[model samples]
Target: MSSTDSSQLQQQQQQLAEWKLQRLIKSLEEVRGGGTSVITLIVSCKDQLTRTSAKIAEELSVASNIKSRQRLKLYKKTPPNGLIILCGEVGDDTTSRGKERKLLVDFEPFKPVQRSFYVCNSAFHLDPLRELLTSHERYGFVVTEGNGCLIAEVQGNVKKTLFRLTASLPNKHRRGGQSALRFDRLRAESRLALVKKVAEAAGEVFLQKDATVSVKGLVVAGCGDLKNELKARLDPKLQNVIIKMVDTAYGGEAGLDQACDLAADALAGVRLVEERRAIGSLLEAATREDGAIRHAVFGTQEVTAALRLGACGRVIVWEGTELEAVTRRHAETGEEKVDIVAPRVAPVVQTERDGGGNGGGGGWEELQRVPLIEWLDREVAAKGGELTLVSDRTPEGLQLVRGLGGLGALLRFGVQAEVLESFEESKEDGGDGGQERETRGGEEGDDGDDFF
Candidate 1:
């Protein structure tokens, strides 16, 4: 294949992988392990398969290891890039009446793993894989106060401070009768010097020779408003992408780490901000258009119909979408067609076809069913369109799922739902399809009424 063709193919593969991983993360989030029974084993290309096998055998005494070991043996050889296996007893662990459950999920990633690791915790250690899904773009981190300032960069799993400075701001001369006005004037001059020092150092660390910011985004964090004063003197390009201004209880290295924790939500939402903007654009076109030449549509039926007719421009789907793609065939005409059906009804359709067939009185036979997430990716790419996955972390993401049925698209030309939909769009359960109970998360009681 030509270079352009190869690049396009790679891009499509990445999109499909991203959708699959997003669904995997959602599924893993729902799993609740009983105490420290969950086992997470990540095997990279560099790890020895024999040693990995030995470790699994030794872990047989653990709650879920027997099954995990058996599953591990199925792979005679290690995957080229690597594989992750997360297994444990996952269910309601708080009460005696709660039922017991066992879950083992193993898959090879689309990219190579740098190292191998193992852990047993109440919940699976998902940080390793999450890093793979996160943007590799670096971001600037600035932490400063009356004492000092530290400038750093964070990219994926690493954080490094490239510049450090110590400032000895003036303090009142309490021993002698030093003039109050003199002390105050000296303090202001020191503050001005600190600002200029920070500006020069920031340029050296965060700017390129071409005069543009080196990082994709920037986050300023420290104890007081000193960081704000410093921000004003930084390059205009760097200021534009500032993700947050975090407040910490200390300055220097300790405060830099603290700032990371405080500003984590902002950092995570950097990618979501772009996705939300796209949703807003699609929503705008959807509301303004009229008649059959409509520009926007929500729900599975409208989006699928548009894609089938080569009219889809942009497609956005929820990370936890419930629809499954099913292939159905006409019994009378011997014709085949594809449809998105709810999981509950898909089995019934398959059983009906197995017994014989039924449609137009005889019935349409269900031939095959693939994952909706993967199917949607392939469908959109086939038509030269892009698809994005959104989580319910933000208000717009939640609104899209609750009001728009979790799947929507912008269309080049409109398509009628009646000509496409075989059955009514499936209603999602009260905004909790794959509800996760995070150990550190405190928003379990939230009903999300504020977003509306």
Candidate 2:
């Protein structure tokens, strides 16, 4: 070939490389920051899978123009499915002979705001992959000869190592090549907390000086009497949380059984079932849901909803329901979560007729469903919003149901009954107001005005 022709070809190739790098940058810039977007990249290399995959990941990270300067982790694997499962454009694929290795790339994007997590896998040339993972045309990489896999993460706009695990050849399979495959599979199955998408304030409580954070698992309990109680008691005012409330029939302590059933429905998503340490962590970080909390003064629904939605600036739930599990969803984000109480339930009791009994002997009930103590918990979490539940000074109690137990709170203000039951007509002192109101499906005077 003539010298002039060769020089022209080199110039054209350089232009193409620049164009591809620009395209990748544009694509990455679409993701917002502050834990809103998450990206995961997995690469399977056959010949030099580990080295090649690492190189590509570094390039992609640099190329991605995320708003928050997010972190990116590249996982490497060499499994039996490496050939079929991996996809990406590399230098070797288009050549006459597979002499040179090609790089395959894939992209996965997550939007916490949308409550959606998606995966996209594709291939790219080695030159471009390296350019995108790291900004510069070339960056140094650590390539271990025997290590099969590695994982890295970026958070708060800075790349940091959350955790990295490598497979060491086990003696039992030392003689064969397949030993690495078993190790890779086992590592993938183990759970890790890479995504800390929960709110900042919520995250703080989990990291308290003395308190430890634990995520047990998530169990869904459909709507029933227990669900109602949960709604009435534990519901918060947060938005975009990750909890789901369905309908069912059972009630009482057995209500938890129905929760197990609901949780089973999500068997396909085993990760959701994994329990965290306490309900506080979930509530502090969960996204918002579609429904908004209706403010009612006489009952717990309004207040509980406010707390669950992360709206209550300061809250206090009665001591009776302490240490109970609460399921709260965000009003805007539809993120649902289960909250485990740290201290316990502690609520003040007041004497009042059952309203259902004729002789006023059924016993008094709490003026509010959740006690002031519980409200305090939700209030602390709703700041800027964050919720921080402090250790309670009052003693704890076991009585879950209030009102029926004669416990109540001295709310910020005297709760207006209309606020609790928005549907009920306001009480008036006129002559025609003497007749008592009756609940649906209940006979007139059967439960009496003093029973509820």
Candidate 3:
């Protein structure tokens, strides 16, 4: 294929991988912790095929022994080369008391790990899985002159020293003029050889593991011209992976850590940066409009209304906000009941009796509460809009909560001009009072009640 075609193919593959990863993350997020009764197990099958079954059987035996009441069923299937198995099970509360439901998750596209292990717990913990996914980026680090090492971060786990090498140069001033010139040439050749060796080692690891897609990039570090020499000598494939070069105090494994630490911001994943950018865009658009009735809406009530009308194209919510909605039910006898709810809110009993007397029937049951954020997530997805849960970690994210009232949305189109004019008129006449009224108007529904 032509060079351009090859580059395009690689880009397509990368986009596909990113989409798959996003889907996997969403799937993992959907798996709520099942309290303490759930059993989560992950075992690496990187050994000989004969030992793989035996290893899994041994681990399963231990898990079964610990959770004797819960019968663990192993899904018997042909093990692929370099395959790891992650499975979980919890008592099926919806069914009979003794029954259990197993969660057999598919973690494809991720290579099997090098070790074997199992875990039993009350909840299906996903930290290990997340680490496995995030650490797929293979980065080669080389500090020229003395020390160099290759490091790979997969799913967050850092594998230091995939390969290490050291080289010493000859002293140039050890002899007279002609001897000194010969020594200088020899030193240059030796440094070039060292660079070639480092590049070759990186190629070997990346090629052996088929890490072309997973490799994020490479970093070269040194004080003098050695780093540039290494870069110049790197194989074409290795050269493509080299991201940046820096001067560092250490070489070898320590240099690897230092490079990663210094370049942490640059190495922050693309998804995180994109998320921040999207939030910033919403903020900018809102600020430019400078009114409540514009292409962007802020505060919980306005955003909720925009969502209800299918006018919102994106929903931005502050992480960890306790948003809620009330669900009310009425009977044929004209008796009414109200219950405050949020997404995933557990059911509760009401103590008030129906008849308010000794012989009265039991109080009406309150509907199951769902968390407001969870409800918003479903709503945004249903409307084919994006939902971003921004945290207080960054300044812009913090402003989304503290400055913009914790919730906002970008609309498909601007609101009516008349509404904007009315808001402006109110602001002019009442000053602070008018602004307060406008805010209250936005907070209240058409019926003058607080919007849910």
Candidate 4:
């Protein structure tokens, strides 16, 4: 192939590699190994690539000795950068002995870890993975009527019903007569009592287990008006946790299952809800215009500056944003540097040759594109700040992206009220600009106004 063709091929390969890495990151973020027998193993291939497979096999052998029917599976076909993750299902026996075992798998060739180690754990140990992925999610579910049940997504689809209550409610209809009027009044009182009982049950679950503290949001569903009445009667803590309310045909476990299915979109988009809340908090604080609590900043430059100063408490960025960064390298010393820049800008180039006659030398490469969300995620985490990836899946997220330049931050310390006021002013001035930018560069069909 010609030099041009070779260069194009290399660039394509790099793009493909980056894409694969991103895909793996997303997969790992979403994966939650079910069952108590799930095992996760991370091994370093730095010096033992040749023996890595055998080392893994040995580890599995030892694990099998302790856990029955243990089957080890690699996330990737080949280890990337001398790193491999082995996730095993310890008690899986669905595969026939005569047939080859097929395991649900995903791979990440490169992970942020310093050393190689093996761990045999039940319940798919995730702390090791969370260190790199930084996914903290909490979800809850509630199904109620005359009866009520509350479940939480402890992990993945595995839900543990935290509370269950059954109340005998009075009949809905009564015959017309003076006696019937008394019966109707009695039934009204009975229904009211049932509502109180259901609310008390929910409050007990929320308070005893501290569900409000851990559950990010909840879905409530049920037949009849009982669900609404329960909501009205619930304590403020329980009431605030409700994310969605749906009408269901059943109650109890079946109702919970139906609620889960109906609210799958909300549950799956919990991150979006979180981002909305975070952004809303920032907006609220900004509106106060209180200098002591004016600890919020928006726009890319301001957020980056705040993060660098360690003032960022949380970083929020729109889901689909690309940023330009510059990478510089020295010729003789082999020193390197990188700096973030605005998107779509041409890369800066600086070349230098050593004293030798040869043309080979280090140079600065400009316009290297990076996923802004990924970069900000790492930056915020490294700075001990929470990172929220907001998308158009939520109205608040859309507003953030469309009105606030697709980036914002909650600071650790307060800034001058004028500074935040300026941000709001800039937002007002550039709100249309941001929307136009999204229209031209964002995902097609995104109106920045529709509710998800």
Candidate 5:
């Protein structure tokens, strides 16, 4: 046992440890995106040996310095033979007060940045400790698209791999500790890869249409072996759409099936109509016949023009399209409007009477100016079209709007042409009422959640 030989062995061990940490970080980068507001790291050891724990913490601090400026919180737990460490972010503040300042100066600045804070707790309990960490304001859930199942909760300004879905690796899988280390390392890496795939898939579908469709929410439906895997792979922006989870393995096709069914069922009993392409064509024709030729899709350069001319009953758009503005070129006279009804709405009003009703709720329901897809539902109702939504009762015989794509048809069948004029009148009256309520509420400082 020569001194040089012992020194050489120590150097090799240190290099190996550094290599493992780098690999762990690489795994986190592969899987996390969008919904991740923070990065949380959870580490467990047999004994919270002061030197070992401090060494690990130092490595984390250095690694985080090169990442985003997310707040990093670190916690260490020590047992007779092992130790555990947890790190994440809190609030908008994540800067280290004194000596640590120079360490993180070079990392990319986080938007809405502020000072980062790190706190350590010696508590041995895992559940409360985990709850304490994830409950921070920036706590956003993370999921991926492929691999069926997996979910992660991230925290921190710098996108560090804080806590993983598999927080702990079992001892039985370890062969002289080496196998256990490899298994843990492999699991984290694979999960990260899945997260990347899901983010790409979500982004691909989101940009398919002409409009920008922001993900308002996300839901993981059905449960199976891949539950956590799927949850971890999903994009963070879609977290809002997550309504519920049903237990099943409907697989790829079933994913949309379950989601649509749930959304439709939830929206049941809400009197709405379905207007598909047929209504678009009808509206197009009507605008041309009324001598509001400018109101026709071709006569107008902007959608607002058609809207101002009262040409649009409503616009139907697919999910993910941005609500900013429409940019498609106008169709020629016989170009066949985007749909069957788009060119006919204005024409239909020509033969029908105008300036009919001025009052509200006079044996007529209120017409709404809603999103394009919602307008589809209204159009379907107008045309006496069947309303099919996802439901348990098959004999109900309704047209299904399936999924959260938000597609709908408008209801415009029985109303006399004269009734259309009342829609404008009703809108004006509603606006006045809304104004009055807002004024009174402002005086009273109404902080209620519901808005109009």
Candidate 6:
């Protein structure tokens, strides 16, 4: 496919992997099992999966083939980020006999697994995976007020100073000499030069080898207006990304430390602001009175229908949504089917919690549960659409989660949700293009790789 198509597919795949990893981590935290019953495995991308699988063939033989066959086989070669699997039998509690359940989850970690490990323990090993999930994005900090400047970058939690420069400003004469006025002029020029130096150093620390800003955000901090002066001296591109201008009692390393603590709120608010923007855009389109030209649709059933009909594109889902992609068998006919929905009640989980939910003698028997995000990713990727996960911390986000049923989408064109739902287009032959899609810049990519 084209470069644009490749990038879009990669993004969707990343989102899917992220969703699965988070869901697994949350569910695994609650699991309790015998010392030698629950198995946890971590393999780095450098390791060969074929060899690893052969080593654990006996250990994995017990897992359900229907559930694991594709997962195990998909990586004829290992993925770029490696793999993490927590599987095996576990009880409702720490003891072996209360209630037994099969728990299995396998997916790529957020970052590459640095080392390989395997164990059967009372609880699933999570510390290593948690470390990998820590974001690698860097944040740049410039702490200075015309003297003892500190330019540093923070990756994950570690901070490394890029430079520490004492200002070269002229010292004023003690006596009220005729040259005392000249020293003040020299000091002003030196300060301006210092700001320019700090700005250049910050650009170096924040940008990558290709000149792209690698830092997620920049925080300029120091006492007085020096921080503001430094921001103004920064490159236009860097100036635009400056998250905060904080004040500190000191400059250099001490101020750098203080800036980290002081700018914490701004750093946190960056993500919350993005979440609001994502949901706010969707809400705007959804509430517009122009029915014939409105590109917004909400509610899972309506959004799913729009997606399948090849209309809606940008999908925004609440990060904390409890919806699941499920399959149910007809109580009488026993015919199986797929559904994207929320659980009727609080879900009791483990292996069967998602993949094999069933009604306790209810008329509609639940069949399987998968994360709703995964299903949305597939449809969104197929249409070259964007998938955003909006957090619930902001008011706009709450409107999306509470008012929009936790999911909403903006269509490629203005198509009524009702009309799109009932518009049944016949499936074309396999040799012919199956589902016709609105051309998005280029013709819709027909390459159907399982970007799970």
The candidate that achieves the highest lDDT relative to the unseen native structure: 1
lDDT of 1: 0.69
Error of 1 at 194 (Å): 13
Model 4 Cα lDDT, one tens digit per residue, 263-365: 7667753443344466778787557666455578787657765665678887776656655333434444444444455544443433432121134544443
Q: Which candidate would rank higher by lDDT, 3 or 6?
A: 6
* Decreasing TM-score order of the candidates: 6, 1, 3, 4, 5, 2
- Would you estimate the TM-scores of all the predictions? 0.52, 0.16, 0.44, 0.38, 0.21, 0.55
**Which candidate do you rate higher for TM-score, 1 or 2?**
1
Given candidate 5, what's the lDDT at residue 337? 15
**Candidate 6 per-residue lDDT over residues 35-153, each given as its tens digit:** 56677777788998877777566655443431343456767777798887776666444445855666667777766787888766778888887676466677888888755588887
lDDT of 5: 0.31
On residues 41-121, what C-alpha lDDT tens digit does candidate 1 reach at each position?
899977777788788766668834427777777888789988888887765334253554666778898888889988888
RMSD after Cα superposition, model 6: 12.7
Ranked by lDDT, top first? 1, 6, 4, 3, 5, 2
Candidate maximizing TM-score = 6
Is candidate 2 or 4 superior in TM-score? 4
Provide the global lDDT of candidate 4 against the true structure: 0.55
Better of 4 and 5 by TM-score: 4
Task: Count the clashes in each prediction.
Answer: 5, 117, 15, 3, 134, 0
List candidate 5 segments past 4 Å from native: 1-178, 207-218, 222-236, 258-264, 267-452
Report lDDT per candidate.
0.69, 0.29, 0.53, 0.55, 0.31, 0.66
Writing each residue's lDDT as its tens digit, candidate 5 over 60-127 gives 65336434223222223333222223322222133233312111111221111122223332211234
What is candidate 4's CA lDDT for residue 50?
36
Ten-residue region with minimum lDDT total, candidate 6: 430-439
Ranking 1 against 3 by TM-score, winner: 1
Which stretches of candidate 4 lie above 4 Å from their native place?
1-140, 143-277, 291-293, 308-310, 327-368, 377-398, 417-452
Better of 3 and 6 by TM-score: 6
Residue pairs in candidate 6 whose N, alpha carbon or C atoms collide under 3 angstroms: none
Candidate 3 global lDDT: 0.53
